[model samples]
Target: MEATPRPSINIMTALLLLSLHGFIGPAAMAEQPSISADQASLLALKQHITDDPEDLLSTNWTETTSVCNWVGITCGTTHTSRVTRLNLACMGLSGTLPPQLGNLSFLAYFNITNNTFHGSLPVELSHLRRLQYFSVRGNFFEGEIPPWLASLPRLKYLFLNANGFSGTIPESICNVSTLQTLDLSENQLAGTILPLIFNIPLLKVIDLSNNQLSGAMPSSVFSESPLLDIDHSSNSLSGVLPQNICGNLPNLQGLFLSFNQFSGGIPSSLSECRQLQVLALSVNNFSGTIPRELGNLTLLNGLYLGVNNLIEYGSGGVVSTRGDVYSYGILLMETFTGKGPTDEMFSGEESLKRWVKNSLPDAVGDVLDAKLLSREELTAAKLECVSTILELAAHCCTELPGERKGMNDVLAKLEKIRTVLGQM
Candidate 1:
C-alpha cells in the first residue's frame, strides 16, 4: 500500500481562506436591532427642523441604540424602552411637528415649549393615549385646537399658552377626568364660558387669562375639587364673583381674578381658605371695605388689590393700595424665611416691612421665621443669609406701591442673596 501525498498551499491561498471566514462571522451576530419608533421620530424631526446647527441633538441621539441612553429620554424601572419623556424645551427647534410622533405609544410626557414651531397641532397626537403632559407654550403654533385631544385618557397637564390658537376650547376637553392642570392663556380663544369644565374633579390649576372669553364666571368651577390655583385675569368675564369662591376649595393657594369686570365686595368667606397664599384681585370693580377678616389669613403672601374701589372696614383706617405693597413684602419674607405672614413676624397690624426697616440694626433676626430656629445645626453664615433676605423683603414691601419694588427687582435681589448664600 502506497501513502497519498498532501497538496501544498501558498501564502496567498491561506489569506484567501481567512478572508472568506471573516465574511461569515457577521451572520452569527446575536444583537437585536436598536432602532425604535422614538428614534425614527427624532430622526424625522432633525431632518424637518432647520435649527440646532450646533449638532447638540446628533451628539447624544442615535437610532439602533437604547433610548434610555439618549439625552432627554427617561426610562422606567424594568428598562423596557419607551420615550417616556421628551424635553426639547428652549432648544430653538423651528419646524412644524411631524405626525409620526404618534408612533411612541408609551410616551407620557412631550414638551417642545418655548420654541418656534408653527402651524396647527398635529391631529396624530390623539393617538398618544398614555400622554400625561403636553406643553407647547411660548411658541408660534396657530389654528384651532384639535378636538380629538379629549380622548386622551391619562392627560393631566396641557399648556398651550402664548400661542395663536383661536376658536372656543373644544368641549371635549371636559371628558379628560384625570386632567389636573389646564392652561390656555394668552390665546385668541373667544365665546362664552363652557360649564362642562367645572365638572372635572381632579382639576387643580386652570388659567384662562388674556383671552377673549366672556360671560359670567362658572359657579361650580371649584365645587368638588382640591383646586389650589385659578387664574382668569385679563378676560372679558362679567358679573359678581361667586360668594363662596373659597368655600368649596379648602386647599386654594392662589386666586387671580385681576383686570376683569368682576363686581361686588371682597368676600369675607374667603378667609376660610387657611392655605391661601397669592390673592390678586386688582383692576376690578370690587367695592366696600377691605375685609378685616382677610388680615386673618395667616398663609397669605402676595395680595394685590390695587386700582379697585376699596374702603377700610374700621374707622380712621384708610384702605390704600399700599396694603398690596405690604402683602408683596410679606411674600418676599415668606420666600426668604419660609414662613407665612401670620407666622410670628407680622401677627397683628404691625406690618413686617415697617418693623424691619425702622429697626434695621436690631431687626436682623427680628423678622426671621421662628421655624428656622429649630434647625440649630445650620451654619452662622446661612443664618445671616436668611437675615439678608428678610431685610430685602422689608425694602420691597414699602408703605407706597410706587416705592415697593416690582417682581423683577425682587427676583434680582433674591438671586443676589442666593448667590451670597451659596458661597457660604
Candidate 2:
C-alpha cells in the first residue's frame, strides 16, 4: 500500500501560477512588479557614495525594506512607488552623482547640499521633468553646470553657490521659464550675465555675487524680471545703475550691489523701492553724496554705506566713508525716525539726532516714525522697545566722532534691541 505514489506532474498549474505572480527574489526585483525603475535609480545613487560615515544609506536602504521606507526618499502613495523627494543634505556623503538619478522621473525636490560630492552633474538629470528644487551648494562640483539644465521647463530654485563651477552661465539658462531663485554665487563663472536672466517672469532672486561677471546690468534686464532680491555684489560689474531700478520690481526687498566698479550716485529712483529691507552699496566707485532720495526708503533695516569715496564726509583731516562714523550715526537716526537729517523741519541749528535726543526716554513717541506710533497695539511692551532703539540711534550720532559709540557696540546693542523686541 505504502505512500500513494507521491502527487506528481503538476507542471502546467505551477507554470500558470508563476506567470500570474511573477518573480519575487532580490534579483527579479531588478525587473518587474517587485522593485521599480525608481528603486533601481536610487540604489544606483547609493552605490556611488563610497563613504557615508553616518550609515544613512547602508542601514536604511536594504532588500528587506521598501524603497519608500528608506530615509531621504519620498514616494507617491497613490500609485506604484515613485520617488518624489531625495534630500541627503549635510550628511557627509561623498562621491559623484551618477546619471542614473535621471531615472527618477517623478522626483521634484533634490538637494545634496554641504557634501563633498565632486565631478560634473550627469546630463541625464535633465530627464527629471518634475524637478523643482535642485541645490548642490557647498560641494566641490566643477565644470560648467550641465547644459541640459535648460531643458527642465518646471525647474525653479537652483542653487549652485559655493562650488568650483566655471565658465559662462549658458544663455539657455533662460529657457527654464519657471526659475524663481538662481544663485550662481561664489563660483568662477565669468562673462557678462545673460541679459534675459532678469527677464524671467517668475524669478524672485538673482545672486551672481562674487563671480567674475562684467558689463552693466542691462536696462532691458530690469524691465521684466520684477524680482524680490538682487545681489550682484563683489564682481567687476560696472556702469551706472538703471534710473528706474526699483520701478518694475514693485516687490523688491533686498538689493546688494557692493564692492563693484559701479560709479555713479545712488540712483534717486531707489526711493521707489518702498519695500526695500536692505540697501548695501559699500566699496564701489559711487561718489557724490548719497542721494537725499535714499532717506525715503522707509522700510530699510540694513544700510551699509561704508568703504566708498564719500570725500566730503570724514573725521580728522582725511576723507573716507569708513572714517565718517558720524554720517553712519546720522543714517541710523534717519532710519528709525523716517526723517532725513536735512528734512525741511530741521533748521540751521536743529538736527535729526538733536531732535530725538531732546525727547529721549520719556518722549519716544515724538521721535519714532508715525507709522510705528500708529501701531495702536504698542501698549507698554512695544513702546519701551521703541525708546531703546531711538536712544541707541541718538547715542550713535553724538557730537564728536571720538564720543560716538563704535559700530561693534552699535551692532551688539541693535541685536539686543531686536531680541528684546522679539524680532530676532
Best by lDDT: 2
Off by over 4 Å in 1: 1-35, 62-67, 76-80, 221-223, 313-397, 400-424
Query: Per-residue lDDT for 134-192 in model 2, tens only?
Result: 99998999998777898997998999999999999998888888999999999999989
What TM-score should be assigned to candidate 1? 0.67
Clashes of 2: 0
**Candidate 1 C-alpha error for residue 115, in Å:** 1.6
Model 1 per-residue lDDT at 29: 37
Task: Name the TM-score of candidate 2.
Answer: 0.69
Clashes of each: 2, 0
Q: Write the per-residue lDDT of candidate 1 for residues 1-424, one digit (tens) a residue.
A: 8989989999878767766888544533322132356678777776767777556677767665676787667765533455678888888678888888886777899899888888888888889989999999989888887788888999999999999999998898888899999999999999877877866788889999999989888765445667888888889888887777666778889888887888888888889888998787877888988887987899886677755677532223644444544555665555444555444656533454456556454445545555355456455677666666666667665555556665566668879887996676
- Assess every candidate by TM-score: 0.67, 0.69
